[model samples]
Target: MAKLSPKNLHCELVVTVDEKINPHIMRDRNTGQIYADDDYLYRLKLRSEKRVIECDGLRYLDHSLTVDEEGNQELVLRGSCPSGERTEVEVVHRFSIPVRGRYIEERITIVNCGKDRYYLEDMRFGFRRGLCPAYEPGQLADDISRFRLVAVPYRKVGISQDKGSPSPGARPSVKRQEYTMEDMIEGKFSNVDWRNDETVVGQDLVDRYRLRSEGWAWTDGRCGLLIVKYNDEMIEYSLVERNGYSRRECLVFGGAGFALYREPRPASVLEPQTKVSFGPTRYIFFDGGWKKAFYLFRDFMAEKGHGLPDGYNPPVNWNVLYDIGWYHSDREKLFKHYNLEALHREARKARDLGCELLYLDPGWEVCEGTTLWDEERLGRVEDLVRTLKEEFGLELGYRTIGRVYRDEFPNEWYIQRSKEKGQYIRPIGSDGKPIGFWEPCTECREWWEEKLRRILGITGEGVKFMMFDEFDWRGPCFNPSHGHPVPSTPEGHVRAVYRLIEEVRRRCPEVLV
Candidate 1:
């Protein structure tokens, strides 16, 4: 067992590691509490329900903090699970609890070591039992009655208009939820992806409805367990709070939600010699109640070593993404007679409402595909920026469905152009045509140049902030043209986007993405 107390960490952790065995049950010093621990460390069924992985039986080989190219150190643990056959599969787990930070984040990776091809149905990393559920004088049982909060970034309810060029027809009113336990448990609740219906949970919702990248928070009112999920990939987590095993309050079991699906959306295959992993589900144990959970999560995010947003502080300064229509334009509201005036009013309204910035989404583009502002149809971007800042004294922000729109300007211009510079493009299709208009290959040189130019251009034009929405870029570009393997992947795409965003900061050091 090895203990780690990263610098300035208000807390310390004890990890139980043994040769030929994965680390289990890491307890904190204050509460003697354990999370993502060994009690049920390797809980997912690998091939089938009967073939669940027994990590305690697996062989632990190495654990170290490897320095990434940027010279930052990362904690990584490696182990192997025997298939009860010829080849041994390697399991790589990367994790860390930052100095004085409140979360224990560990990503999952399974590599095929042997020559035999592997097929895995589902894999869940953490079993969600016994994770900081406390009891008090309340009549409710501690386990079943403890609170669980799920943060829905955007839950559309009805039609609505928001700060934008105003397309009322396109904007849907979002019913942002303050979810109680019932609302979450009743939703399509399977956190694990494969063979979901096979479990006691019936087919509750479609694949999209599953809501993989959910922000899950659990607390017994004293200490709390909040998992900040950043993507809809392998980091998905399940939260069940109902009458079940162990706890009279409720049994809240969760594992890493990152599972691979086959027919609809696919999870990565555990083929021999291939590698796949995702974690870093940020969690925190703060000194407060459920009311402050969201606030706490936001503060801890900057500390998780992921880059912080511009002026990344909390009571997160306020933006307009979730309160109303996700910044979509209502064509009727946007191009109408009161277009510019309406924007002026909205900007003033946001300012008066105490918002620091007004977020405009999906409307100002000349067409859905073009990044150029629709000056002719919706007035000049320069005028809008001046009004928002000069008149309203609020920062100007904007976003599009994806960075590059396909409706007008095909991705080909950037794709072909970038490719000429030995850059890569993410073809929207398996057809290999480099014609994915809706999706830009961030790996391509054009993507980087255009983003930098666009950021600087918009910032220079008085825009201070941006969200490259709909950039849920697909992984590890299989485009060998992108300098990756022939079989491109989601990871590659993610890295490319990260690089571009970093470049955006370097060039427009003041602009926020």
Candidate 2:
């Protein structure tokens, strides 16, 4: 006898059966009469019955063995309902793609049985990466992170147009009509794709791989197709809603959802229609080796009959800082008054309380200065960095709001740009209208690049990290210096900031770059 290896297991099945039925009855037990209509009949006796056949006694007609030729076992299960209207369900499952040197897969299926029309409201499939849960909420604070589910769709309702608009030859020309999902899909929706992945940490080293496609579904009277993938020991599900290959828009429906967890006991009896819910599903991808998982899962899904959108890039892990203090005044104040010395002393008291970085909030600079170092209060910036590094074994970081002090650096390019754009320094009034005495310039790329370069040079001596403050406050650039008056959308603005960070990384690659 040979020991069963974890990698070579698979399950597949196909079920066919009779229709299911459900019965609804109204009875008068005391009168010994079943009433079809109690008010209308003097004395009525009626009996009605209906039959329902749900998923029952459907065993795997195929092999349930754990090992197969494809490095994993495949399971295909099929069944049918015997109600007046017959319906069939086909379930295909692939199990045991290796992750952290283990193989696993779990699949489930539900078929419509009741007389009432059934809707495929939502579908969810989930699995554990290793012996442990995939990820916790706290792990998401860093740049490179792993998540359980990568992408899910948000449901959007379509708006219809009115039919009373004037014709082109009428007195006034009508406005161009707003497009529909069909129109957009035909015109713009093309070359889309779905990619997903997961990573598992091991005792000695991390192991990862691309998840292969596990199963897929095509339902009657439904406008879209749903596909599921069990890859890299994680689940990847994609719903592509389109009209043939002609045109389609990927609509992501936003609402509460759930992921099925492993039941404590498979044989435990349960009631039907149990309510379940899950947390907010964010579309995020893994970093490093985990990206391969996404590619693999995407390929598997395409193979399972889901159409890949043209040129769709699966979300990848990118460095993003959601500066909480930028929007919240209280958070800003808390960070400002944070006791660094006390924190350092307390950290030394505990064996596990040490941080490599000490983030300083805004207001470190003298409210009246233009230089990087606030000479009056913070003293020399270099001295502070040295003290933090030497005493607490931590690197110091500071925030910059990109404001220039006219009295100090009187020849700043931003001031000139502001004047050219006809922008005035509005005084911070009680009404929050005219806010304070600093020149505001359109965020020209050249201006920001030059500013970052100067700041980097000044802080290059000792400072290790830099936090760009008030990033959200800097609105879209509309001046001639910006090279274009077109407003920068949120996505464009985020990309620009990322580019700036990349430049900073390039400049300071070794100093914890």
Candidate 3:
């Protein structure tokens, strides 16, 4: 067949695998690892086989018209099997146009001479944007473009509900569990595998995102009837699910093609065969515009297909934070020269730019005889919070440093109680060890709870958020009387601090707990 280019195309081919051969035995030529046994084995195998073409009829083209192997015009298939029961399959694929745009098509086929039946599982076909990087160590950082799987079969397992339990005559009711693939395919599946690297990994990083695994399963099954409309352009892949009583389906897409083979347990069974047809379909292509593509995909699916499944809520959008202010005094230097008025102005600017919360760092209270709000230097906390909400439409939050308030106020009660309980007091230097100062009464959970309630009541009045900080630190205390048994490990201390946070959340759910 003549090599296909972006300019001229339309082709088809047929591939068949017998029933007795194990499809899982096929190893990837590039990695030398079995490609058919991985999580999405069949799909990977179809991607690797690059020989078949899809068109109106099969016709061999001039060899000179084809692209050189190194020029990206070659369709090639390389395979390996360790058990030596089946013939290795090879198919060479070549593309004419160097760049893929609006309209495109691909074709592929497999020849099986093995003695076993091969079950056809899935097929993937599409014109991938950007260069596909060779599967080598540490190559992800250099690859700019990615191979995205445009379509695939959906595999899913469903659970059934149970009937009345513990009833003697209730017929031992049971429900059925089922598994199946959806016939439809759409969306972009990337070829950047993150399972290989850890440091520059793609999975957890927020900015680099991909279609989730669960989303792929929902659109499996609607074979030939599916159409991928890119903007106004549409590309069609043909599908043939049941070729005959003895053969399975052949799924073809884009300018690329795919064939499936089911592996057999023993080497003696006859291979199964099937023929499938797709296309006469159209592709609506857009130029260098991804936003348009996304909108078109969503609209086409909504109008002609099903939308996202039930219970599906898009991931929450969160403000990406660099470094939160008000946590460390060092960061306060960013606005140190600014007084209350200047700080309020800067905060208002941040709010206008979509900042959801304003964080206040520690040093809010004057550590004196009456640990009162430091009105002289920091201005009125309540007034600032009110201005943030009414004037700037922003939320307020503060850092909580678990230290004794040395001034006169409701906090003074906590100081007095700490003394009465003999929890701990500042000790004069003896050795070089850290000294224990004011400590909460660990034995009296009520004391902690009451103190927290009082503190929350005062702070939560005007604040919309609270950043509890400095709760994890070492302190000397083996006082059995006050109930704290001196944390034995760092993990224990961490857990204790987390427990306090949980308590705060349980008490105030509306406060962004």
Candidate 4:
């Protein structure tokens, strides 16, 4: 048995290697509580085989403690997967214990060593099994009923537009769910990927479990593990949950192991001598309950440059759409209520309410996705800024989006969802006509430049805030001329969006986006 107890962490980790190596023990040193033991660390399936193989089944080759690029000391375990008479794959599991941070970083690498190509069906990592549920009570641990899964949803939930507006005091709340062993088994740890489901792309609804990059926390009210993944690929892999067994149940974390069909859409293949990596999944351990865990996570993110600037106090914006009503793209109501006169009245209300800014929703755009300021209906952007500041003492801001209510671009600039024989010009519906609306591909260089230029034009006209909404990727584009891949990938799309934001900040440093 080899043990590692980092001085900064409150937990102890260990691995046992006699015949096979298993990095499989986590113990909270505070109360002498043991969380996992002799657990299977990873599970991966080969395309040709029906049997899912685990890390424990691999023959142990060697183990060592090495320093990684980030200067953290890591425990590295190497193993080889065997076929009938030969070694086919090499697996390496790494656990990095940060000397200054209260967390462990886990990553797995699978290198194809066989002569033939290998198509991976699935891959999952973490403490693969345990003697009992993590929430189960023992002399050294808290009761099972006291355990809770605390998640701060990545998007708005519990508030629905169709059901009518919530009261003025209503706000989005955190989801704190209590679960039994059965509930954990039923839900497992499957992640929700919005890009895979096209039907729900533009639909409005409530969802609490959207797999966000921010990550989630699981707690027993005394100690907890905060799992965060930095990957922003088009599809999301499951992380953190429990799996059930008749005689033994395991609390799984980091990688869920089950592969979703759409995440690696157009399934990827590992050619011979190729290396595929899963994650640099982080497990941040903390004492106390979920709130403390969240605060710690926030601090961790801040350290990673995701936090707001120091001493930057945000202003309270008064969105008039709540009072005037959400007309969406309805031209009739928009023309009647979204003009300057109506907005002036709303500006007065914002002034009266001590609001610092008057935020426009969807009606300020020439078209919903145009990002062009409707100077004809809303007056010039400069005038709106002047009146709001000089007359009502409020700053000016508006919403910018990705999907267009009307097709305002060349056919090639929009998303190409189909490459059928007759679908060359535009996306052909089942009925053989062009799709009604257009979703601009962020990865399209022309559209990307145009969108950035338009957004900068408005912000340059003294707009203090810009609310980026409705920019979710609907699907991939199949346009070869767009300067992206023939079928645009989620990673490319996300990077384009990030590049857009970065460029905006670079040009308009003072503007809050």
Candidate 5:
């Protein structure tokens, strides 16, 4: 029954809504424009207590809009709904189309607005405009198949289908994938939950760069929809079907919904007047293929201060760890294969061959992953770096395992200490009981801090680059002493990793992560 229309150099965004404050059409002025969409951009995906909350379904309320000095526009719509006469909740949805960047951001705040509490679950935010109403439901689904859906799952060693990194004008690492609607129906493509080593391939065995991809893209040939779950802890890229453009044909892509690591805890009370911020879910529409859209996203990220410094230059050198088969070691030969003199000689040879740096992968630490270096074998890391520079004029770097080596490192000491403090990763049971065996709980604040200190210590030894191998420690942790949720979630693990990485950057900003 109401609408809001805005125009800019990108395109004109016409937002139409009904009594429920749901946006029906977000038609772009020019379909062929770089940032234009072919149809009503998409509808929002939402749910509470298993009941779908559509824009037209709820009773419409009040709406308003505001524009800043920079020409950024934010539309706020407010409405209220009762849950079968029990809890009454108010919803305030804010859709912001920024003056800059290639994506439009969305955030929804749900408040009880009543004396009682409200619970929302499995809520995913996505877009779904009626897809070619001229076609039948079955036919629409068929049409969606023409536009392939690209799902990017997060992996430490992401098996990229691309050639190189996304440095400047280099060929972007775009992993083009097409998971069918059949895959969504059968639950084959799961992007939210973390997969273990059994399901994950080329993780601990091989070494590769991290893609940080947990998103999806739908593209035909010229234009498409891009919904990326960028750096949000509570969200995951999803493709589950919902009420949308078709009965069953309209496929949803690049949307985010709630993904639990384990059984979710009971919903806490939403006190009256308390506002909950749902998302800033990223949406980008662009001309050409999905690559062009993704590149726009990449550029947006750089504009947001994630890119390198103005004049920073990275040294792309060789790592003798994985190729030479020295990555995984139980110290069978000790340092005989890679001792101080051997590394010195190798550095001399490699330096002469124009290798900018010599990476002392393994066999440098006295114990596997231990900060202590062997005096007799590789000598001190500082001394080795000085020798690598002084003797061979080579740059210095280090690579270490994130986990303590079972065969070589002293695990008993760590285990006994953990046992004494009742702080091991117990993974099951709500009673905070041990689940038999254990892996060092990275979620433990102490353990995380220790790793931070360890990384900074090594970086202070003048390391140019540090490779954190086997870092994605996964599983449910029931140990309450670790100071994480009863069952550690994928999001919790990711947040912990991000925090630790941030801390390292804060302390040692010069060292390459």
Candidate 6:
């Protein structure tokens, strides 16, 4: 038994052992609020020799406080793997509560001690702590109703819910989806992962309330528990699923576990003799509602260099899409309202309306996703930028997408999904046209280099803003010649996107992406 009593923090974290070391509770000293209860630390699953082994029900070994490289005190808890498995694995849970900080940072380091190559199936780095005691089935307590699970899913980040609205605030991506603890207790959730367009068989059969979110907060207006994980990969966590109507009401981090939506198994592997760390997940105990959690998330992100630059004052953009309308790759309709002359009229309107930038949506390019400026239709890119600035008094900006309106690129450069089966490329659109509208695999070196070159060319012409939109993961790209892993993982897709953005910034640091 041990208590982590950080002097600067308002709460004390208590760890206890009952076969395993459980980070049992975190209690707020000032308000006398019990923020956490019934907390177990971690769970891991591995596959070897066609046999599945679970590293849960861990046996407690010892714990100690040590100074990290940055001089922060970290509480390290050591544990032994269960005696049942033939293979040996060592797991350690490290937690740090920085001085004068409101959050506890946690991570689990797993070291495979055996010789066999182990495939990591599932790893719950942090355990869910119950907010309230167990209640009878179908019964909801008033206190429980006060507690809401607030989550900000990754997809909603940086995107405005309403496209036509004014410039979004700093926390535009912060979605305050408040589902009361009572909601989960009462079993309120969709049968499928419809939110992400994924459906699975017998998913609803288990009454687990699963939600996809980068981080979440369990709050009751006055006090809250915030959990956030910041990783390079475009991955999220599910901390809201409570299994099968049981009264264990804690939100488990690996409750539903990590896997591609609708995939039968995990795509992660742990080679022998390698050490893997699962998190640096922040566990914050704060005062006030779920918004406080969001503020902390923002602050943490800023610390990670994800925030705006010191002097970033983005111009108020007047998007011409509202007036010009999406031409949908129809040359006839596009020329009618989306030509350079029409855009000049819109720029005049933007200048008169006090807008600082005239944002082109979809028609400036020869075709959507080509990233080629239609010099014949819109004149030269540099000339247009000078005109937009000198004549209209507005900076130039445009949107770019990964999906092509037509198949200009080689068929091999496009996305190839296994689900497409024998079909080599995407079929024609429902309109019986070869809009061959599939996203080019960004991981393809040739496509990546070409896209980078095109974007750099546009930015070089004094384009101030470039919005890289619709570059989401369509699925694993199965093209063998692409040089990426066969059935490329979501992480690979995300890294490729990041690489593109980073390279763009490296070349054109002044342009806002």
Q: How would you encode candidate 1's per-residue C-alpha lDDT over 1-513 as one tens digit per residue? A: 554333123333334456554444444455544443333345333552234454334556777765455433357777776455533567777766554455666566677776555555444455434322234213433343455454432222343343346564564545533454544444434333322112112233333333343455555566666666554443343433332223322333343543223211234356656776554555566555555676765565555655555767422134443333332334554466335555566666687777877776656665453566767665777777776678777777777444443433334423332223443344433344544344455666555566556556655676677676566543323334445444444455566667766776676666677
Top candidate on TM-score is: 6
TM-scores of the candidates in the order shown: 0.51, 0.34, 0.30, 0.77, 0.71, 0.81
lDDT per residue, candidate 2, 1-513, as tens digits?
Answer: 111222221211111222311111112222222111111100111111332224322322232334455444433333332224443332223233332222133344343333332333223222111111123222221111221212212111223233355566655422222222333233422212221111101112111111111222211111112223332212222222211111211222111112122111111111233212222111111122323444544654465566756874332111112232222223345345423443344334322344466555544444422334544444566776677667757666655654443433323333332324553443344455643335433245665666567667646767666666544323334455554434333334445555666777677753332
Highest lDDT scorer: 6
Q: Write the per-residue lDDT of candidate 4 for residues 47-163, one digit (tens) a residue.
A: 534343333356677888876677668788888754454367778887778766767777777777767776766555566535354455231223333455555334223424333
Better of 1 and 6 by lDDT: 6
CA shift at 194, candidate 4, in angstroms?
A: 7.1
Per-residue lDDT over 67-175 for candidate 3, one digit per residue giving the tens place of the 0 to 100 score:
5454333232223222223333322233222233222223233434433344333333332211112332123222211212232222222222232245465444232
Model 4, runs deviating above 4 Å: 1-9, 46-56, 66-73, 84-89, 98-103, 112-118, 129-176, 185-219, 222-238, 244-247, 255-278, 284-286, 323-333, 421-436
Q: Pairing residues by index, what is the TM-score of model 2?
A: 0.34
Question: Compared with the true structure, what per-residue lDDT tens digits does model 5 show for residues 1-513?
Answer: 566875455544555567455554443334543222222222333344434543323344678889999998888877665234423566676777877644566665666665543445334434554343433443444334456555433222234443335566654343334555444444445332233533112123110111124455656766665666554335433333423333333334333344433111222235555656554556666666767656766765676577778888766565665434553444657655666666766776678788877776776776665545667776667777777778777778777665555433223223222224442332453345533333455677777777677777667777777676655644445566667665555456667777877787777777776
Superior candidate under TM-score, 1 versus 4: 4
Better of 1 and 6 by TM-score: 6
Deviating ranges (above 4 Å) for candidate 3:
1-339, 368-372, 375-380, 403-447, 473-476, 484-496
Cα shift from native, residue 493, model 2 (Å): 3.2
Q: For candidate 5, which ten residues in a row score worst on lDDT?
A: 202-211
Per-candidate Cα lDDT values, in order, are 0.50, 0.33, 0.34, 0.66, 0.53, 0.69
Q: Give a tens-digit lDDT track for model 6, residues 59-158.
A: 7777887765654577887776666543466777777777667667777667777777788766554465453446554444444457777774332334
Model 2, runs deviating above 4 Å? 1-352, 368-371, 401-421, 425-432, 435-446, 473-475, 485-492, 511-513
Which rank order by lDDT, best down to worst? 6, 4, 5, 1, 3, 2
Q: Which candidate, 2 or 6, has the higher TM-score?
A: 6
Clashing pairs in 6: none
Look at candidate 4 and give me any clashing residue pairs. 124-257
